[model samples]
Target: MSNIIKTIDVTDSLENLKDVCDIENGRIAGKIFYDQAIYEQELEKIFARCWLFVAHESQIPNTGDYVTTTMGEDEVIVIRQKDGGIKVFLNACPHRGNKVCFAESGTTRGFICNYHGWSFNVQGNLVGQHESGIYEASDFDKAKWGLKEVAQVDSWKGLVFATFDPQAPTLQEYLGPMTWYLDALFDNQEGGTEFVGGCIRSTYDCNWKIAAENFVGDILHAGWTHDSAARAMLGGSVAKVSDFEESYSVNWNGHGYEFALDTVGNVAVLGESALNKYLHTIKPSVAERLGEFRSNMIGAVSSCTIFPNFSFLAGQNTVRVWQPRGPNKIELFTWVVVNKSAPQEIKEKWRKGAMMTFSPTGVFEMDDGENWEYCTKTAKGRVTAAQDLYIGLGMNSRASDTSLPGNVFKGQLNEANARAYYQQWFDHLNAKSWKELPNRNFGKQEAE
Candidate 1:
């Protein structure tokens, strides 16, 4: 076996991706995020191989309840069975390779293969052979055949995850320093966050990475992108500060983000006065449940990603599952998350806030859709695809902030976050597995 993870030549189809850090001169000239070859490689090197976010534990609340999800392109069935624990299995039937269950989500005692009548239990066991008499004389061991289980599965803060690579680190370890930051959004409440409603599934005519990068890199666009909407609703929203542009830190493993303005509209689902009052009213309770800093950030909008595929706009309270449908097309699955323990009125307020700001009809979403669509159109051009893009902002970055979660940029508009994201993208693209990557890649604090 080759000791080093072999990498696709940076000069091949990815000829434009020249270096790990390239935010100087404000230039990011590459199609690495939207390339066909890179997308396929990600499915193998990153998606198929990494621990992917599958579903929230609450999605399967009762015995035999289940939901169909995806890890990269592989379909998985996550269910709550008799043992009162979550179980996940490849959605493919053991017989004839057909998908056993076709529903997007539901509760089930187990799945019966519609193709051949092979029944599998919630734990993915071949509990019943439809016709045992025909196979009684056969040498097949019933125990040997079960729905193919993902290599590894686990949860953190009630979020379900699974990995195709058996050797990848645990989800906590994989998340590294990001866990500390994520706790602000996911673990703040005593009961934690849960999906208020089912996810909204939509199709986008764009590359999956474009959506991923936008979450981390498009802080500059918020003010202008949603100017009309913000003006109509916010009427001089506080995020006008975000229009000034800023830079963010790059983290090891490429899980990073740019810190933008902290706005009331960005945080609590209620009005600014209501949100602020709630924080003050709940200060004692908030502190008792969550630390002071995390409590304060409850309503703050943060643009962040946990490397690989999971990306979220905390300010908007939207969790996006960017599932790739093809090289140039992607299925955008969005979920609204709210503190489960909050009062009915507060939950409803947050639901309204999330729907108006991030949903398919939200003004901010429509504003961004135009830009993303235009970019996608430009990427298809033979000339434009060959031309490189730029991401060099604050190239010789001169700031260090240990207290912050990841790398720190000099200003909010700096492209540091985008560079950090792409750097890790390159690292994953080049390395085959966690073990194959060099020790220094994760940096000291993040690696541990």
Candidate 2:
């Protein structure tokens, strides 16, 4: 309910975050993209509280399998236990606060701290150290010195997520209505999906919000920014930027998807003819499982973001996590996804195809880094950072239909989703807890 920005005090800045985006009117303050206090609040309120992607279940199918990842900026080790359950532990050693495991991923019986040899098992219990009897009489209970564990770890389909806040909602509830669209990416095959091979990590000199918001509704940029990549791919490796009349932007809570509902347009551009053919064979099945609307989404020309920082290109076969580094920087982790039951050759094609377009050095990926970086860099200008950006393009473009899920907008070019996303960003920073966030049953709503 507050709207003013006059101080750098943490409390004042957080209070003013509500002023950063005016969803009702379609306007946003530029500083929300690079403000330090805002970023600090996000690390605590949003990243720590919301469910965040860690690793795919495929990455750790057996006991002791593990992957090192970050929830917000806090490094964590997400590992499978002997019971075939996953647990996420803070990677910092309790002994001296040094990193326990440095490897990005691997299978192991336990983790040994490199600094002091303080070791912990997959369950995060402190097992031993260099000397066994050194602290026995010193009131040091080894049982109390285990690595900090996340309060929650869960998965939907094959994607794993974790959260540090004990009061955070279940991952299923956090995902909210986004599940309808997620099924298109995840539930396409009988065996579900898994990430193919290793992920690609790269950094962008931009705020995490800037990159996340881009995927929320910036498909309009497709026609202009990525045209060259589309041309260079010889038109077959990327879908044509479609006319506004054929596309849609839909959001639920803060999660959003923008797509041209041309079913095979997404995979067709991967430059894998057989992959396209394969998807065609299953299109009927997808339609039957999810109905005609989401069936068209299985391989459509689309980009989506699940609130906070996780995003993926529906047709491009790339999944991304925009990890925040600081107010002015973000680390991007990219992965190619394929059906768990897919043919090995088809999975390989997805891997290579995703690499060709979204890897660190891929054609489409190269075109976006600088643009995002510059957006963050330029916002440093004192005057520029204070201005309000006009996001009113689709202020009245709402689509009222009970058939489609989420807050649907009529066109992909609209800024409705971006506005909704920023509003959620504001709400998270301003709320006392997750319980204070908005909750409205969305049905028969319009996008305008």
Best by TM-score: 2
Error of 2 at 24 (Å): 1.9
Best by lDDT: 2
**Model 1 alpha-carbon drift over 4 Å, by segment:** 1-30, 242-250, 260-265, 268-276, 287-290, 439-443, 446-448
**Model 1 Cα lDDT, one tens digit per residue, 1-448:** 2211222232223333554224434544335435677677777777866678888888888988888888778788888868777767888876688898899888777788887788888778788877877766786677767888777778999888888777777777777767766776688768888887788887777777677777764566766776677766656544554453443444546676555334333664334455455545655565577666555555555677666667886645678878887667777788877768767776666667767777778767777766776777776666676565777765766465446654555665556667666766666666756766654344346333
**lDDT of the structure predicted as candidate 1:** 0.67
Give per-model TM-scores. Answer: 0.88, 0.93
lDDT of each: 0.67, 0.81
**Candidate 2 C-alpha lDDT tens digits along 1-448:** 1111111222433565546677787788778777787788888778877789999999999999999999899999999999889999888988788999999999999999998788898888888988767777676788878888887889999899988777777887777667878899899778888888698999888889888888988977776787777766655444445553477888877888988778777677667888888788888988888887778888888889988999998867899999999999988999888888878999999899888888888887877887888888877887888788888888888886556767888888789889888877877777767667665333323323
Judge candidate 1 at residue 64 and give its lDDT.
83
Roughly what TM-score does model 1 have, to 2 decimal places? 0.88
Q: For each of the candidates, give the backbone clash count.
A: 27, 9
State each model's C-alpha RMSD to the native: 4.4, 5.0
